[model samples]
Target chain A: MSTTATAIDNKKGLWRGGVSPFKASYGKLMMWFFLLSDAFTFSTLLVTYAFIRWSAPAYKGEASDFVFSTEYWPIPEKVYEAFPGFHGVELPLVFVGLMTFILIMSSVTMVLAVEAGHRMDRKSVVKWMLWTIIGGIAFLGCQAWEWTHFINGTEAGTIGDVVKNGLWINNYEIHGANLTFNQYGPPAFAALFFFITGFHGFHVFSGVVINVIIFFNSATGMYERRGHYEMIEKVGLYWHFVDLVWVFVFTFFYLI
Target chain B: MEQVSNVVVQPADRKKIWGIWKVALILFIVTSIEYVFAFTMSKGMLLNVIFVTLTIVKATYIVSEFMHLGHEIKSLMYSIILPMLFIVWLIVSLVNIEGAAIKGARGTQDFTGSNGATEQVDEGH
Candidate 1:
């Protein structure tokens, strides 16, 4: 007869009727689905890359080390050595390491943002979210720089007695990357590199855009009106998922 | 930082924040270990095992801590992780079959031009 009695009457069995199977909100469940699907897409790309590399003929340098090989799959270490600003320095994997650090730090900030959101602390959430967006943008910029350097190789090629494109040490054509030519090693290498990293970059870019929206909403006290910060937590889940995929991508594509 | 120290914050909340930071530190250390091994270790079964093992370790931490899956109900967690096993199956089967085919084809013919004349096992550069 009373409101409390009515509320208690509405309660159903744990496993049927109106109960949530996973104890997760509808939006959060949907986010998990999105992330799972995204995970499949990325893993497929990476595994296909592995399969293709497996299929390719081995390239061993005269020293027989894959690191300095001029043939076969170009050496992973040799091809990715160009650091930003210091043009000719042979700093292998340093740039990538820096990028990894950036992504990891961004992920950390995202969790912090979600933590702030839990307390209904609008200012803290905004601050942490802004840092995350900045980190994402910086990552995209770094990827652009990496792609530019890779497509327009610095490895010089020597023909007979003359040195053509003195820094052209890579296998693909100099200038930029494309469908047919990749200075790195095999055409497939550049293609996969482009497709995979580009896909991840696009995710980060979209995340930044969404972050801005949430940042705006949080600034305007939208969640405050709703009496919850679940939205921020949901987006935080997505952000961290992106970061997780990058860990796999970095390991498979670069570190391996 | 100062705001986090406000009197309104509970000690339990502070502990949770510190726990997150601890996991972050662990992630950093593991990644650094991966980097060091990448250069020092050669490509082989052992190295591959190490890399895969380390990757799983990193993934566990991320899923458990950052995603808060560690606190999730068993049904929810299993539903998310159990299905990913199929992907691993795909990786193993495809790489094995494809790699074998490539090796067979390679033995019968050489398409790498002059580099094809070199020995199968190369020394370091």
Candidate 2:
């Protein structure tokens, strides 16, 4: 009849419904589950992307010998060469690489914030969170520019005969990607690009918004008054999950 | 109602902080290697295998080090990762089956034509 701590400890109340078997708080556990579901969502999208690309005829010949043709799937390096401010330079994969670096750095800052929060260092949390926000916005900016280029496309008017880096200059006059057509090989190419990257971008956008809220909360000493910074750690999980998704996206969407 | 915060605030752990930077460095190095392969290595199955493997490595570091799941109990880690392993298996097999089916049915035909020519219809708008 002893309902004491020693009794519960000795009894191993793991399945007795008084302990967390996973050793994680309820909020953190739920966040992990949510990320698992999100991982499924992203995996399906990328899998679909791979399926569609695989079904199509792959570009044959050397990578450098690649060309834009409606007859075959476009090589990724050929399509993603346009860099900001250095237009017309065939700097393949550079911009997206920079974007990846930005997201990775932001994730690092978020972890630092969580580390500072463990010590209830409000000042460091604010500083690191602010940097994380900046990195997210910068990433979004890069995405916006990339989307514009994809949508607007290279000067639309040249005849289809003029092939630049494999893309026909005048394919139906309206170049780039849109709701109905894709100048980059197959329609699914642009469609999947927009859908997958756009979905990931939305996640990044929401992550930034949440970071801002956490930043405000930490800045105002909310956690200080409450005596713990568990909230930062939870959000840090979400922020890092976003980064994890990007690592896969960078590989599947761009690198492959 | 005031909810009691039972969590204890610990002092800064410099070793843990340094460990984080080390993981970050590892991630950066892996990404740089991918970039180098992307440009220097030609596109093929070998390059793809390298990229996918590196990506998984980066993902592991993020989930383990940054998300701190690596420090969690074994049950929790397995609960998350085991399901993911199944999901990945499903995706790989399904994508292969579906992709092969489509390719077999189409046989390199120019199906991209006309469907991608919708711009001609919408040009006036």
What is the C-alpha local distance difference test score of each model? Answer: 0.75, 0.82
Off by over 4 Å in 2: A1-12, A156-171, B1-11, B109-125
Provide the interface RMSD of candidate 2 in angstroms, 1 decimal place: 4.6
Q: For model 2, what TM-score does chain A reach?
A: 0.89
Instruction: Please write out the lDDT profile of model 1 over residues A1-256, one tens digit for every residue.
Output: 3665557666655643465668888888889888888889888897888888777665533323333222356657667778999989978889998898898888899898888888877778889989988998899899999988877766563111112455433233343455544545556777888898999999999988998899888777778667678988888888888888888887778876
lDDT per residue (tens digit) for residues A1-256 in model 2: 3477556666556777656769899999999999999999998898898888888777655565554554467788778889989977888888999999999999999999988887877778899999999999999999999999988777532123233465654545546776556566666777888999999999999999999999999888798887888999999999999899999988988888
By TM-score, who's the top model here?
A: 2
Candidate 2 structure, TM-score to reference: 0.87
Positional deviation of residue A31's Cα in model 2 after best superposition, in angstroms: 0.3
Chain A alone, TM-score per model: 0.87, 0.89
Interface RMSD of each: 3.9, 4.6
What is model 2's native contact fraction? 0.65
